[model samples]
Target: MNVKAQYRVGGSGLRENWFIGAGFGAQFFYGDHNRQMYFWDRVVPAYELHAGKWFTSGLGLRLALNGLQNHGVTQNGSHGTGEIYDASKWLEKQEFGYMNVHGDVMFDLMNMIEGYDYQRWHVIPYVGLGMMFTWEVPRSNEISANLGIFNTCYINESFDFTIDVRGSMVNDRFDGEQGGRSDEGMLTLAFGLIYKINYTDWNRPRWEAPPRRGPRRADAAKRLTSELRLSEYDALKKYKDDREVVRQEVAVLVPLPSATVQL
Candidate 1:
């Protein structure tokens, strides 16, 4: 008979689901002070470090620290008489550094809809709201929101490669400009790796089973005695049959006993 082992697998334990990751990418600011969207000159360096926990295969939470450099350039038309239609020239440049600390809810779309496969790649989308802190001449804080999609590829048992494209929205002061109808936001495209600290084997159990309790000593002794008694009875019955056969053989070989009694 085969017995199945009871164990857990794949983020089954709460302590095993935690991971840490770090990434580097570029940030693009979109606001009234910028020349245009998708301009290479407006892109700045950005990076992030995060720790996350997966409660299940489909749901997780992450706390991240995101830091980036922001840039904005203002264009004012030249005032020279001959340059009436000469177009705009760079008037002011705003460059500063900022950081965001946020908590996010991450959902694994593929695992939620289909099923969780550890070896396969997965797409996760996340949204979060937090506060943005700027380190400019006049330091300020503003409410912020983040939306992102993460593409993760499993590299090994404990490591994964991830590419994330996310956009962050903050108050217009994020770029030190305030003339826009909408708040300022930045788009970040990053690549990073995640390392799993606590690995869980779904097929193994952490707890130990209690020792088996068998029959009492007196009961065990009685059972053994009963078995031995049965065995001895069978042996005695066989010996009696053997003795009868011998007696019959001796009477057949020496038929004189009956003849002497008759004489």
Candidate 2:
């Protein structure tokens, strides 16, 4: 059972240099393997201490200590008989807990818009991966072969070799026999989100050099100036035409300009 939360330690103006958090969560197992006392009984409340640094826009590396629990279930015979005894009373309970300690390195990639700082955190998402060492108490006490028997030799305490002890040994799932050691060590991957507390400081670079500038005159200004000059050239050409002058004089019954003016 894995319970993840949304309270990630990040902000717009403040990057999380060091973070310590504690949370309560449960793991629920799937399939027919009935091991835990309850479906969600794998109650693992854990704390993590992590450190991170942003190397580029919306991307950072985080190193953390993540710990959790792995709960396993066992079963014994019930008190009920086929046709005589009650059904529920025959059920037995077998529950055990394992400790999972991990040292994990993860990445947090943020979502950013163009021309905007990647640290701006109205809402952010992240994922994680890690390896854990899982340790659990052995259930079967019948055999001492795999578990290693307690012995003292010579002047010390020792067990009788003449007598062979026999009992039902608890076997692990991977092994066919019982009580041969059930603990396992495995790796896991985790994915979740870190809701940013502030948008300004969420892991943006501390101090950035000013952006470089290009040549001063803008393309837009040059285009507009060229268009205006083209319009003046066309107007001067029309003003020098004799037909345009007679049409303008007849339409107004006067010279086109009241005073002499440069075309």
Candidate 3:
């Protein structure tokens, strides 16, 4: 069985902001062999609420509230006398459950993938591993609250009227077990899309170092020429005093401009 399964389908809300949503989906029994339910099975009708960083990147956790119904067949009275032979008669034990309070920690697995951002409209398939508990109440009791048994056949089988407030009548227990607290600790998983609110700018490129403030090739060449000329002038001036004859020849041949004189 695939450990990864999606349950909650199609989610949408404001991005990078607080969001509240209502979603309905099936809890597949494909996750683990123990969690699967079959036909005529009473599966809970599940819902969830989520709140997280508006549109953040990677691994986010959300709290989920779920409701489940257990409508599976149970052997009545154990294997012995008074043993219920017909499965149809077992309807007396069928119960309706309510889970007004249950919570789970949901893991956003899409965050595990590299560079998976939650800003765009992405169907981020998710799996939830958590616990759920439900209070089982007799279906007959709910019915009797409205319509009491009319026929003599059902008169003896009539639902206890006291259950109208307490829901304590009728033997609607699992596997035909004794009527008492039927609490279960279970693990649940589901796959669904988290439709991130669409945005024009989802990814912003990394900031690049401002293009190096560099001199162009022509500018560099001109700079090199000026430096060489200045160096030659300084060298000539330094040795000219020692060789007065050469100095006079240079002065006679070339008249220095004011710019050169200033240098």
Candidate 4:
């Protein structure tokens, strides 16, 4: 009987290869500004929570809830760098609370180009579109276009260390100011961990087996050394017996006569 082995592929389905993450970083707004400020003065803290699923090794999608704090510089009196008519226009930097809910399409560059494997690193770039809602006092909203890149290092089967650099373009009115360009831009840098849920490996190439062989069967007649027939050998043995027949001699005359006298 021949027994063949099969590959079990039940767990490798649409329900597999999901992931979630959390991250915090700094955000810088390139918005309308006047006068002078230090580099750190225009930056704010940013936070993010995200979940994603990989449809294949090369492609995936993610939804992220990003924001909490955002910084914006507005004119309290006038415009132009260091040319503000009012002295307090430089101090009009508004620290606001906001949230950006966005969905991104991610492409794993190495995995897509080199094929799937347990790689120690992956570089993923993405693009998204979202709405930014600002809160506290007068609540407002703006449509945003997003772009980002992620670098991930392998930690184990279920987790990875990740660093993300994100860039976004929003309506200039979102920051309560109008800039030279029609859209305003923001840049953020974050670090975090990603946990994959029910991750599954992709199918691999199969190997071909060599042909099988067994021991050869043996024949009794083929092992014989001499070429003699059984019937001839038996006839020769009988002839030798017939030719060698001989008579036996006995001495009994003296013994018989003594026994008769004794009786």
Q: Best-fitting candidate, measured by lDDT?
A: 1
Residue 134 lDDT (model 3): 38
CA lDDT scores, all candidates in order: 0.73, 0.32, 0.33, 0.70
- What are the models' TM-scores? 0.66, 0.34, 0.36, 0.67
* Model 3 lDDT per residue over 1-263, tens place: 11212212222234532333334544311111112234324344444443333233332344444434433333342212343334554522233343422222233333333233333322233333333223432221111111111010111111111100011111223223443333222222323223222322224321112222355445645766777788788888878766998788889899787554553
Model 1, 1-263: lDDT tens digits are 22233223344566877899999988887776565433876788889999988777777899988887776664432111232221354345556678988889998877665445668789999999888887665677888899999878989989999998999898876555567547887899889999987855333332222222455445646766777787788888989999999999998988764344554
List all candidate RMSDs to the true structure: 15.7, 22.7, 21.9, 20.6
**Would you list the clashing residue pairs of candidate 4?**
35-82
Could you tell me the TM-score of candidate 3? 0.36
Cα lDDT tens digits, model 4, 25-133, are 8887776662255678768887899999987676789999888876555674222133433355445545667788889999887765544555579999999999888
Candidates 2 and 4 compared: the better one by lDDT is 4
Q: Could you give candidate 2's per-residue lDDT for residues 1-263 as a string of tens digits?
A: 12222123333333433332222323332212333245444233433334444443334444444434433333332111123222354323333333332232222322332222332332223333443322433322221111111111111111111110111112243111223345322122222222222223333333222222443235435655777788788777877896787887798875466676798
Off by over 4 Å in 2: 1-24, 29-38, 42-44, 75-109, 112-129, 139-263
Candidate 1 deviant stretches above 4 angstroms: 1-11, 75-90, 201-263
Q: What TM-score would you give candidate 2 relative to the actual structure? A: 0.34
